[model samples]
Target: MTSSLQAALDPSAIAVIGASENPDKIGGRPLLYLSMFGFRGEVWPVNPKRDEVQGRRTVPRLSALSRAPDLAIIAVPGEAAVAALDECGEVGVKVAIMMASGFGETADPAAQAAERAMVARARARGVRMIGPNSQGLANFGTGAVPSFSSMFLEVPPQDGPVGIVSQSGAMSVVPYGLLRGRGIGVRHTHATGNDADVTVCELAAAVAADPALKLLLLYLESIPDPHHLAEAAAIARDRGLPIVALKSGRTAAGQAAAQSHTGALANEDRLVDAFLERHGIWRADDTTDLVAAAELYLKGWRPGGRRMVAISNSGATCVMAADAASAAGLDLTP
Candidate 1:
């Protein structure tokens, strides 16, 4: 396996720093889901306040651990998260998931400053941080599920070939569940909450290089660096891997709200559309469209020069499809 793929899939052991015994709590769900999903890796819970969480002995701190975990998931409050990350870095943990918020989104100036400090600390230590405000991430290929939402509550992990990257945590899970319901499998799903360090562009470039990944689906509220994203999209296009993007915050009002929420600036919707087109990336209008387009591409059919042939049992359905295609700027002459 390639080094990047190995690194992505080789998170053999994980530690939950704020794990709790209570099933309802945020820290308890990763442990619960990991066990229930039948993860093959070792699971450790670290909580100073608890003797044991979910029948597993809890380590008071990362310093007390014998072996270094490949990945660490921090579910503690925003204030304590930086310290936990520092401890993770000291232990030589490679990747970290920060599920706590109170960073860029918080209206308070002090909170934003604290968030910046956290990012700076992580960067200085050379540790890769996922989010100071995020839902979580999952590697279905390796059974590394580290998300907290009850969305994975009743579902079994369905391993597949598509890798998902989304800015919205809640939206990420929704697509996973939806795609699985439609018999599409996911290789990895990442919710990049308040992307302080790892941007969508970096993740997409990494996913493009992943041998296990056949397709990439992105749900983006805003792109921080258009140049970086364009370059990444170009790489994906060059590799002949299909990238389907669903862009939120398309309208002026929606853009304003997104900017306030993530401290991001949304570019003109038309400019984004042109950029994606130029990079050979497919644009999806809605959630269903996003999944459908991704599924079609992954199943190995590519459109020839934007021309499409319509087939329908009913005249009305055929006409509707033609109209939709025309509206989407697709050629339907054939």
Candidate 2:
């Protein structure tokens, strides 16, 4: 399952369902990114209404394609998205990125049931789904960006050693933007909203297997599957790759907000902390804390212990460093 999920990250061919001619629209943005980023893959645009989308000849639907694409990006809304999935099952498309919303996050009983039904449909057809309300996934390294993030447009991508996997779309790219600002190159950024099918940790495990990665960052509202989270951490630990995670919803109000945002149930904060610690994953307090030490980790500096000696040209600066070290619980040796 992990291998199959990993394959979606670097698909040789992709079909864009609900393709649009307008570049700024959700359906068109992916086509623009794929062309702009230079994804050297077969791109089939599926839009029954259009003969062409973004200059590419369009197929009426997935069934019209000669063969199943490696991945499908479903950009339609509500029942339309489900209908697209039905087509995918018939055509044998193994993976899909669900960009449509109005699912479990809406907190409507019908919507939640719809989300569950979609997942059941996907599983029955052997299709692995990324999201039902996802922003999408982007692999800058391969130019295989199926996402419609304005962040990619606002912040130019430079492929590097870092990868980010989050349940929130904003959190996924927030670290990317921060790292890119510091001249850090990011290779993978993915979000699994609603987690109706694929959870964040499962995707992180796939990302962790990339030989080019040095660091992995995660942002989560919940952990419904700790087994995969542990698997992800094990993979990272085996590679000596640092995993920094920001698990939100420590308070009752925060938990409520998280549940509303992604249909996530909050885990006890202390247990989450212990679980991450046991797996050798660092638990960050905030977004800033998540990427603050990225550079240091990328430089291959792994401190074996907390004992440290402050060294600086200025005596005052050294004193400040010592103070900071002490505050962080690092022992300052005389």
Candidate 3:
């Protein structure tokens, strides 16, 4: 496992820079999540104005923290993200997840330059940055919810075998909400908004290491590193772990939209489809399709033969199931 990803995934302590008092605010939500989700490690809230953030004592600034944290979540605006990271670096923080959204998403030349500068600074300081506009990461098993997504409030987290990684915050949790609604437990649901440093593929590979993970769900707007992604898929396949992916931007309009959203070039739909198929990964059209086969994937079942039979007491049900089977590419033979 890479050192950076290891730090992001299993940090011993976390600092919420720009921490707020309100639980709903971006600055305060991580603290709220860590508390609600039962994170046991020390949580330092870095806020100058507040004495305490959500009952946890405030450290006023990153340097004031008693000890350097393994992971830091910068919740300030895009303009101040770099400065916040600078402090994190001074404190020797290993990884910083920037939750602000203005760096590269605007497609502006200066903003793009700022995004590069952020990455450059992180490297110089020996700290890894996850996203310039990321929603943050979640580990339900450890209760390390380093995100502000309200999905957890709506859909309670469970320590199951499912892992989720996405390029968009909404896309990441939307699928999570649906999968949870269907009674599936998820262990990791991570959103790499801009993916300035930690690409979705890298994070996916890290989560694949969990022995408990049976299924990995990915929602990507771009294929930043296909070689690594294919390698990750190969590893999962070897372990009998199925990877289901929803790579958006199928149409020209969708491609443009995705490009603007993530500030990256979208891979051609046909090529992405081919890549996934070659890697033994299933391609999903939407959230529903992405997780529909989830239960089946968890079952760890494979057909011995193509020939099959549909048995139902009701003639109508039999006909419907037979139609579904045909749609699923199963051959019905006597």
Candidate 4:
């Protein structure tokens, strides 16, 4: 059965565990974002220290909630993360996000073990986990800004046709920041940190179902579930939507960094190249390359012919345009 990313991606209600009042902090940022971004759902902020967070009244703890929320954000410290998961599962919460780090990514035996335990507990309770060391997730469609990313703070979120799902938190919003800077609006931007449960591929498949999303971008350190990703690619292809992938681990250095960050084993680089092409997904090198061709794709310009001709009054403009076309893999007649 395909795992529907409904609960995690667009929850009806959210429980912010370890919620805070400070907008800069991890717990508090989501509260502020949900408020400012116009999330039309119930937000229960769990923290005993405050009566309210970002103007939303705090609920003291998850147990005191009147009803079980669809999703839980574990913004508590590493020590309190798993315990918070247990409580969320008891309340029938379907998805929980562990935004805290020091899990398997730490490479320490205890940290790895802790990550394993967290996954196991979630499995037993039938609750899906998002990350152990993640930046969190954001859905502009639902205004579910459960992420603590400072990127959204710097660059305001605008709903549009692009969907971003990445293995790295930085990779997720960096492209969003770029797109917004270029006046391109993005609908979904998600970071599947550690990939403990909800993988980038699985989440991508879910977001691909959105009728409004015209372009889907993925940033991967490892291909955890190729079969699932294949399904997502197929869906996007059927809808005439395009998927672009930025698969890291190209060199020993990037591979080592990916391993330390996500605990993901590096797949062979050439194989990854073939995999992306075989699935109709264009492979990108960096954040810039990932969103570089985005505006062109969004313009809905269907090519009439493979012929290339540049027309401009200024010779300088024609030469510059020709160089850019060649760089972007577009045919240009010299």
Q: Judged by lDDT, which candidate is best?
A: 2
* Tens digit per residue, CA lDDT, model 2, 37-79: 9899999999999898889999998988889998999999988
Cα lDDT of all candidates, in order?
0.78, 0.91, 0.87, 0.88
Clashes of each: 0, 0, 0, 0
Task: Name the regions of candidate 3 deviating beyond 4 angstroms.
Answer: 305-334
Q: Could you tell me the TM-score of candidate 3?
A: 0.92
lDDT of 4 by residue, 1-334 (tens): 2342698878899999989888889888988888988989999999988888777788877889999898899999877888998888788888888898888887699989988887888788888888878788899988998999999989988999999999899999999999999999999999989998888898899989899999999999999899889999999988989888889989999899999998888889988888888898889878788889798788877678766889889999998988888876788887
All candidates: CA RMSD (Å): 2.8, 2.2, 2.6, 3.3
lDDT (C-alpha) at residue 312 in model 4: 88
**Model 4 ranges with Cα > 4 A deviation:** 1-4, 302-334
The CA lDDT at 128 in model 3 is 85
Instruction: Judging by TM-score against the true structure, name the best candidate.
Output: 2
Q: What shift in Å separates residue 116 of candidate 1 from its native position after superposition?
A: 1.3
Looking at model 4, the pairs that clash are: none
How big is the positional error of residue 267 in model 3, measured in Å on the Cα after superposition?
0.7
Ranking of all predicted structures according to lDDT, beginning with the best and ending with the worst? 2, 4, 3, 1
Per residue, candidate 1 scores C-alpha lDDT tens digits across 1-334 of: 2232244345678899999998778798889878876679888999999898999999999888889887788989865887898887788777788888877876788888887787787777766777767777777777777888777775555778888888778778888888888888887887878878776666666666667677889888887877767766777777777888988888889887776666556878988898888887788889989877766788787655878888878989889889989998888865
